[model samples]
Target: MANFFTTALFPVMNQYFGMPVTFLIHGVICLVYFFFVKTSVPETKGKSLEEIEKLLQKG
Candidate 1:
């Protein structure tokens, strides 16, 4: 599913924005995703199912 969008959008973005700009855009997107996961997702390492569920339910 992700590949489908990447294949479709990459060429158009590259054509209009050029390679460097396209990569910078992707970099910004990755930074946004990093922050979102860092803040919004819970850490589940060594945690039990019940604990994880409680964290999600609290949200």
Candidate 2:
């Protein structure tokens, strides 16, 4: 998925913004994505599968 976006957008981004700006934009995008997932996803690191299933089922 990341590869797909990189391949599809790299040319357009590079053409418009050049390599440095393109990389900065990608970094910012990744940071935003990281925070979005961090906040919205539940942590199940120590939980059993059954407990995880119940958590999701509650939602």
Candidate 3:
């Protein structure tokens, strides 16, 4: 669904902003999304399943 929407919208975005601006817009959006996910997600390296389950259950 998202792919289709982006595919359809890319032409309109490119038409108004041109290819270079469109690519820059996408790159910025990807970087922002990456940072948001990286900060918001929890890290559970080497944690046991029971410990992970307890952590999730607390929420």
> Largest lDDT belongs to which candidate?
2
Q: Candidate 1, after superposition: displacement of residue 41 in Å?
A: 0.6
Alpha carbon lDDT of each predicted model: 0.88, 0.93, 0.85
Candidate 2 Cα misplacement greater than 4 A, ranges? none
What C-alpha lDDT does candidate 2 achieve relative to the native structure? Answer: 0.93
Q: C-alpha displacement of 29 in model 2, angstroms?
A: 0.7
> What are the clashing pairs of model 1?
none
Worst 10 residues of 1 by lDDT: 1-10
- Superior by lDDT: candidate 1 or candidate 2: 2
lDDT of 1: 0.88
Local accuracy of candidate 1 as per-residue lDDT tens digits, 1-59 = 64587678889999999999998987887788899999988899999999999988998
TM-score of 1: 0.86
- Tell me, by TM-score, which candidate is best: 1
For candidate 3, the lDDT comes to 0.85
Shift of residue 44 alpha carbon in model 3, Å = 4.1
